[model samples]
Target: MIGSLLYLTASRPNIMFSVFLCARFQADPKESHLTAVKRIFRYLLGTQGLGIWYPRHSTSFKIVGFSDSDFAGCKVDRKSTSGTCQFIG
Candidate 1:
């Protein structure tokens, strides 16, 4: 199930964070993790119309990216967490 969700993340960036969070427990997933994955599937089913779109023709384009990190954000491993996003227009 995690594998399928990871593959979908390529086109459905909105679910990337939640999917990856649930994936972290793949080695020893609990009941809660299964519940979370089910919630993500439900979200995708309801949001089928939402997605990123790219124009086929354009005279010019601009790309922008933003990223942030938190120091020692992970309670289990005491490791930093970071995320990034890119926008094109």
Candidate 2:
């Protein structure tokens, strides 16, 4: 279930934070975790049109990038996790 949600997150950036929080419990998930995960699915069901979109128009090319991190935000273990993505011209 988490795997599917994580996969969808590639295009659904809106759910990134919620999905990442639930992902921490995949190793030993409990009922609460399952409920939280289900909530995400329900959210998706209600907001299926939400996703990344780029206008198909000619424009000056430029580099794009993003960075994210969890500062001691680990749920199971106290480990800082960081994620970054970049698009260079």
Best by TM-score: 1
lDDT of candidate 2 at residue 13, scale 0 to 100: 81
Name the weakest run of 10 consecutive residues (lDDT summed) in model 2. Answer: 49-58
Off by over 4 Å in 1: 52-89
Q: List model 2 lDDT by residue over 1-89, tens digit each.
A: 88899999888888899999999888998999999998999999999776545556738655698999989898888899999898845
Q: Give the Cα-based TM-score of candidate 1 against the true structure.
A: 0.59
* Candidate number achieving the greatest lDDT relative to the actual structure: 1
lDDT of residue 40 for candidate 1: 98
Give the clashing pairs for model 2: none
Candidate 1 clashes: the total is 0
Candidate 1: worst-modelled 10 consecutive residues by lDDT = 50-59
Show pairs that collide, candidate 1.
none
Displacement of residue 74 (Cα, Å) in model 2 is 21
